[model samples]
Target: MTATNLLPRNRRPADGPSPGSARTKRRRRPGLMLTLGLTGLGLLVVLAVVAPWIWGDRAEELGPSVHLGSSGEHWLGTDALGRDIFARTMVATRLTLELSALATLIASTVGITLGTLIWVSGPRIRAVGLRVIDVMISYPAVILALAIAAILDPGPKACVIAIGAAGSPSFARLTANLAASVAGRDFVGSARLLGVGPLRLMRRHILPNIAEPLLVLLSVSYAHTLMALSGLSFLGLGVQLPDYDWGQLLAGGLQSLYTNPVEAVGPAVAIVLAGLSASFVGDGLAAAANRSRRADAPAKATKPAEANAAAAVGTAPAVPDDAVLVVDDLRVLRKDGTALVDGVSFHIGAAEIVGVVGESGSGKSLTAMAAARLLPGGLHATARTAELRHPDSAALDLVAPGAENAETRRRLAVEIGIVYQDPSASFNPALKLGGQLTETLRVHLKASRREAREQAIEQLDFVRLTDPASRLRQYPHELSGGMRQRAMIAAALLTRPRLIIADEPTTALDVTVQAEVLRLLRAANERDGTAMLFISHDIAVVGDLCDRVLVMYAGRLVEELTAEDVREGRARHPYTQALLAATPRLDTAAAAPAESAGGPEASAGEPASAEPVRTLAAIPGRPPQPDERPPGCAFAPRCPQVLAACHDTPPPVHSPAPGLSVLCHLEQAGARTGETGTDKPLEAAR
Candidate 1:
């Protein structure tokens, strides 16, 4: 039931179908419900826009002088004023709807913009802005409107501004909070590393993801604003008596409610209906957006198609003699000065794929980010010198302190791209995918709008996205998970960078899509000679994609080996061996049958076979905390191969072969004993 039991007995590598072909077969096209809902919303918009013109002068005309009840000549009857109830009601409804709708639009626009800006601004600015908004929202909206209307003139515009101003703070606070939350997501970090500036990042990535909540806020706020406007109008501080505003109608009808109750009820019903319709539309849009976002959640199950994709692109490119990316003694320390990555060194040559593998918090990703000078907040990289080969100059040292000039950073961003774990969260919800992709091309390549657009489409095509031209018009929310990831990669590749850093690129995708992406990356390396540094926690993935594998443990390099070495069970480090042993094999049959008599297996020893009821072994205890690291060796406490010397002196790096290295006291002592080639530490190799 444990992970080890999932491995195949023989463990032969799997050969499955290509991810692109599998996606082609299984991709769910957009359903008709969304299309129909959008159409209905569009019609409602038209109705709201032209309702005044349709009802026209009839609103002022007196009906056939008939009283209440529905009839041919005076449908829904005449009011106490003998006005055409149907016509007047329509006109009043239009006016009320327009004013409230306009006010709502203004409020939402102002609120969301302010909120997003506040969220993007520093903590001090946001604190002040939020306090100011809190003070504004404390007052009752109707009182605010009345106070403003009493001072300024009584008019619809005055009512709208006052009501909108009152509602603005709420929406602003909501938007700012939403934007701030999304701004910290992995996708945003990825976009930043891609060299997307703040403005473009907001427009393309942050805004779109927050649209659903914003729409919901707008809808609810519109209803509240409408009610406030009506209340003001009823109090004679709104659109004035002469106009056919619904609130005024209700106010006038209230005087005659004893004799003609229908007068007040008719306008009242219209107000309720308008509010209902708007609420429905908002709810529907919000529901649709929620579903769309959920649909893009990362895949949890791996598929055969992914295996095939890996197989198809499994071949490694010839490693160039000159290093394209070089990292020397790179160290990343936390804000508290505790090392997360310490003294790690590696290099990727032209057209090479170097995979960094480790358990969680092994610092593989930190190392990759450090190579591109894109460390996360609160983490500082020191003792580093990452050199990147530039087409115009010799190898440029990217990790050298204070080397990040604007022009230099920009050049690196354009020439060296990164693909992140979560692609959907990386994009701006407000902008179309095409626009996002094109902006990268325009900024980095200096392509004209038309040329950039063309390049965007071309990049989409390269990622194997179907209907590349039409797809460009779609936003990130419209695309599937795999499609969104592909779009992100396309955007990265548009600049035609010489090197790429892909951090868990397949983690959020279905196995099929993962395979397709892996294939695409391999092809990029082989066909375009784009050197890459790929980081993952999955050893199998590293084995499938990388040319060379670097194993890291507790912030230091533990072992370096070839992909073939890993596959052939030649890994030397105990951690590396444990990782290989822990990987789940797709070909293995489940020990706990699909349905169990007792229950599902949640622990080690659930019967799988008659082979003495083997129980899966788990690595017990947590990794060492950064600050509490042991003096002699950070990992020695947990390492099963501990020795007396290990507690006193830290291990030094020992090279057993030209390209292989390990940092362990055991390996060091073995080297000293002149048994370098034959010595194998602790567990069986791999």
Candidate 2:
């Protein structure tokens, strides 16, 4: 079903949830499971605390005779050793609770610290530590506990120590995953650009974001500790036998079960109750956490930036005199000699929207990042010649000294605005939507708080957000997906940057919202005279909106098409043609025509069958990995028109039309006969 059909029938185009929903679930305590779980847990706590005074002072004193049945003044009867069963049960429960709680504390402290540290560490340390953690994670918890118990003193102290050590690995793994996820969010990237220190970022943003998940993990850890404590005691490695922790009591009572089963039955029931309580509470917490996240997630299946110089346009300027951004052979490679983006080059004229289209792993995003020089943590990016000449700043090499540092970031922020795919991740959860936007102004424009707030309001209005003023007070979770996206665009535009680098900014939105956002971006490009490098996986969006569409495959630009070329399905490269053909169409059951499949290339030799193939034409095989790209053409292995020469020699780029280029042997040879040229004027290519 389409995103529009999934929404409420009466829903307005620009609307969102109530502001109250954005309140973090951490503070919301109500819910049947939470209440019941807490009540049950509280009861357990009270029982453990008052346990010592509940039974008579002499818990160990002999009660009349051994194996006595329930009688007046001797509730729960006497055990095999003539000890009062009631007194022994209470004492055992108290000791079990105490040791398990201590164990959980130790596990949480050690695990969370180490996990965060390992997650943020350099690649070398992260790799070695992760391998060690992997080995530990593979070990059975029982075995881990047993080993620790065997190594240390074998009593309650060792029992707690063993439980903590055994449980720490699980907590560490959970924390690491949580941290990694938080690190991937766009807000974290924003913070980094704003010069937030690594330590500060984690403490303020990462930790709080992971708090709810960590709370659930803590509950699970408690359950693990309880089980370890009992199992250890049962194996005679826990609290000393005479002191009577839960497992030891049960074991001692089992000896006389045939004669008096109540003694053994009682402790078994206690263990079951304690375990059930923790599981119930943990499940409740997990459910609540999930609910909060779901509520925060904008409901098309959900639902789903910048610039200025950028601000004046009555008519499109015939082409700009000089390109605003230019790059000559940009390369992105890892230290391991793996090339992710190979010898890529492109330019954006002022106010021109250039769209990069490719499938996953086609290096579309990596190429876009080359413009901002934000090519992730370890990889290196260099351009034979890279220049960004913004209206407000002198031209600077994108690969110059301190390029990866704060100085380059300042230039980028002023000259180029970046919008990401997931708007929800782009804004900080804890900050109000207005505050984040305003902070951008305060940082880049050096606007005072009041001035920033005013400018932020103007930006919000510019994006046509509803109730723009009130929205400033709402946290990101309060807004719908579309609203958040508009807010992100507003943030990007705050600096009035001359160019915008949008990376699949519309991929997360529904068709209607996507169309709306595309309109906004187009207006930014045309009205504000701001150029754009639009990166997207959506071919349709590129066809409808971009002036020039670039087809990237396996780290190489295979084809360049004009808006008319893409709209008319005139892709010249087999890879580009395959991409167009693979896209689903609602107009007719017939697959895209032969011209659409490989443009004229797919039908270079064969006559069109009387009936066009109705089946969707899909290109087989995935894109080659960075280290596995073919020596010649990367697409040759999957290309329908593959030739021996195609596999032996890479095809050079050819211009079939003024502004249209393709990297295909057939297109390069002589496939242009009888074909119409692209719509873009020849001068546009110059």
Candidate 3:
């Protein structure tokens, strides 16, 4: 009853950028120069389209004065034949644009189709296509165009055919490469599992995402087509003389160069303008598309306190001396400077298994990824302090730019191994198992091929993956799910890393397989004295495997306790308590409904209104979305013990017991010792 809701009526991130965060929102404003260029192109296109009616043939016939300069009668002056250059240029644009459009159309249609086929094809066919494209790319486009033109009567039709043929292979190659990358993404894999047909996925998801790229390619390719058309015509295999296309005009001007040079330069200028216009317009569309995608991204907010982070973070706890990894005041912010992981601090000791547990979207994975220095693309992570110490090496400050130090980052990259949720996607399908697994040893250990091979097989067998020798030869897709995971762990072991960060590595496996993988992980830690940070939403597994556990809620670390406390369900936080209650119990039958007025007596004579409404207790609503997250305690809205200050002030981490920390106002109520009843001992940077 004491909890208050101070959130605005319509929930959204508060307006204006936070100080020093340099937050930038992507704007949908169109590019002014691009608009003008496109407008110019539009006018040229209209001239081409309406040339027959708008442009007068009266000026097409030869006039009395040949090679005359600009006058009232002739705007662009007289050509060598005394024909009006303005009229000739207008008609030439019609022919030039038509040829370019036709060639591009033919090329794009054939290219996209062939590319899709190549992308969807089996390895053998795809390899063949790639080779053929490579050969085509190496061969000169001009020679190919010339040969086709000579073979097909050396005319306009032949020129168009040659241009299309020359352009198709390039487009096919681009589309095939882009399609392969897009198809490999997680969302596309999800779509496939949902029974969405390949064609539907291509048309609906893949094409829409790649639309901007394809259009830019089309525009740039259109310019190429235009140049090719003019070149072939200028070489006499294209539009004939007296036809006076831009190329022919250029060709005709050579003899008169000393007298009137504009004839030659005029067509060159036109071509350059058209090429630039096309490129500018295409670039604008790509920018606009990029903005649209960013706009569609889910809204995220960095708490306002982050603007005054130095004062706000007034922290607690220090990284233990035995700590192999120490992260102080870590934050992961969105492009808009919204915090995904805010002011999270923790450490992992040598040879210790630490569990980071949270519901989905609680920033568990984000924090882990940041600590590993592998935040996903577009997400930026920073820390007030970060120092990773290896027993044999100096401490590496991860807060520094990755390139600022040479040896430290290279060493850390090899020393900290990672196991992902989906093992199959981690390995490249094109690589053999042995080659991929042995690659880690070759990189970090600098082991030779034979030595790496031996180690890889030995590690694979250690993980209990049967037929280690056979798995080494097989491709990733050839292995079963469990085999793939075990193989992944095998690869990680090859590094002999001091620390392994497993981010829900068992989530995608069957229960039996999951147990086997978890066993392997435990065996790794026990046998090698390797520290492991296991992240998962399954509290039971965390309890069974971890020495200590950290609980995250709404991007903040809310509680830290021993794994023994987790197994005993002795959590002090209401959110964790609710999570425990909601987990289904299989050792006993489900509890019966609560008694309603002692049953029989109530049914006999009691009014219906007198009967109590007996319903199972459930958490009332969903976790607040990113934009709607509470200003104070993120969990306060749902917390049964929420206090008055819980609605207005964020809580700081405090030690409730030895090696135990909780971020809750209730946990700190009795311990407020400093000014404003909100201060705590600051966490040490080291």
Candidate 4:
């Protein structure tokens, strides 16, 4: 997708700014330093354009008295050649700024282009490029420029080239590192998996995300370039004789320093002022960028009554069909044909919350991404059927041949929203929260600026975000983790899509914020009947919020049970039982031994050796890797109740109770006879 799809256009309405827009600008006003820096830069540019024309004649005219000190007639005295020192300094502004500006442009263009190319290239090329940058930067920029200047004829053109080439290595190194960091972010990966072209991805996502740091670096480079050019001119290798700069003026004044001290002071002061101007501008831009990184403070903590009031909902809106999403025999395979997610099948009904629970690397998120056709590059997904049904369109088979075209992807985007695990990485750091949130409305619904803003505010308020309108002016980094997640929820629900694939959405949040997010999600589902494919590793969280839970281990589903079944100790799989046992309990008093009910006095009579020592339960061993999985059940090695037959044979899926499926040898064996195996009792822990 193009940036215009998410960013606001510059079109002005005949009716003027919308009510929301009229109240506040898209972003807050620039800080005092930024304003001052901009003002100084503007003034310098004006002087560069007009100074030579206004003072050229006077600067060339010989004064009656040579080597004159500061006086009423001569503010900065006269040089040895009887030229006006102040006029000469003023006249040199154009040439000085011209050389530096051109040099900066060359450095930025070459450096940024090389750095971006390095980031996008293969590992070998990137390694070579990084080494090249290091080698170039090892030489001091001024020394390198001096060598280049000595090789070329002394002139302005040569000076610009030398300085520009000397400055490029630093820019290149910084750009490469910045681009690499941004390219691996979740948002960038999402855009790529969604079929955004490489060029568009770089332009719309990577560049914008990295622009702030590049801008600050550019300003600093310009200042350095100006200094380098001035030094070259002072050494008689730049600007030549006729075309003078501050450096040449200083050169001439230094010859008669004792007699005409003010002459050198004039040029020296001008150079210092110019350098200060660039420094101020760079500092200002850096401060602004830092503010973007440290976004607005989080909203006040949510009160219990307020949370309850916000979560309250009436009857849920009726959905068009029962099942919002359905997948059968789903598999996500790497290019080498190793299955990351193998044979995962499930369905989500209207307004139902289906949680996929697993340990790390168990393919919980892979399955969800496969269902949405958002698997990363180098990985392809296939299934017998992967169908998505939205109220706005007919059913779409995401895994069907030629189903990944622009139109199909657009439809998929409109129908499904994804809430990624890291809220910070889910957004474009350069864009405001409002623009990113309202992008769906503007692109999919063709909403007007005013309409989108109003609806965005409403959604933000619904998610319990305080100062909803003000938040529209803030950037992503300005908010706290909880606030950003809430905004992310608002962004997802803005279009009211049929399904929201929340991939571990609450993993980064603290307990209090996690609870609030769960409430908000539950409320959204209840009010809109939106189906959710909630993916998380936290069994307690899944058990609390989900209607049905699918437990996965080592790229395969091991068990399926209802929320009540998970809570009431009815899980049939050994892996699921182990996960339950590993969960820590909060109520120590309740879990305390019955013998200790009379406290220390009652326990005093008992032998100290008879006292029970409690320890937190933990599962032994780790889940198997995808490619290195055992021949039979993937979890067989980790299963505590592993049998000899289980080592050589894959377990068959068996339904011992209504709506419960277990992939276990015991379950399969139980189905052969009248006996049904008993599941270990589990405590209901939140």
lDDT of 1 by residue, 516-594 (tens): 7887888778868888888887788887778999988777787888988876657766567666656655444353453
Candidate 2 TM-score, C-alpha based: 0.76
Pairs of residues at least 3 apart in sequence or in different chains that clash in candidate 1: 16-308, 204-428, 205-427, 205-428, 208-429, 208-430
Residues 226-323, candidate 3: write the lDDT tens digits.
88888998888998755657777777666677897655666777777787777777777766654122212334454444432321234536667788
- Point out the higher-scoring one by TM-score: 2 or 4: 2
For model 2, which pairs clash? Answer: 299-302, 300-303, 304-481, 304-482, 305-489, 310-528, 311-528
Q: List the candidates' TM-scores in order.
A: 0.69, 0.76, 0.57, 0.69
Give me the displacement of residue 86 in model 2, in angstroms.
1.3
Candidate with top lDDT is: 4
**Error in Å for residue 368 of model 2:** 1.0
For model 3, where is the 10-residue window of minimal lDDT?
Answer: 677-686
Highest TM-score model number: 2
Question: Best to worst by lDDT, what's the order?
Answer: 4, 2, 3, 1
Score candidate 4 by TM-score against the native. Answer: 0.69
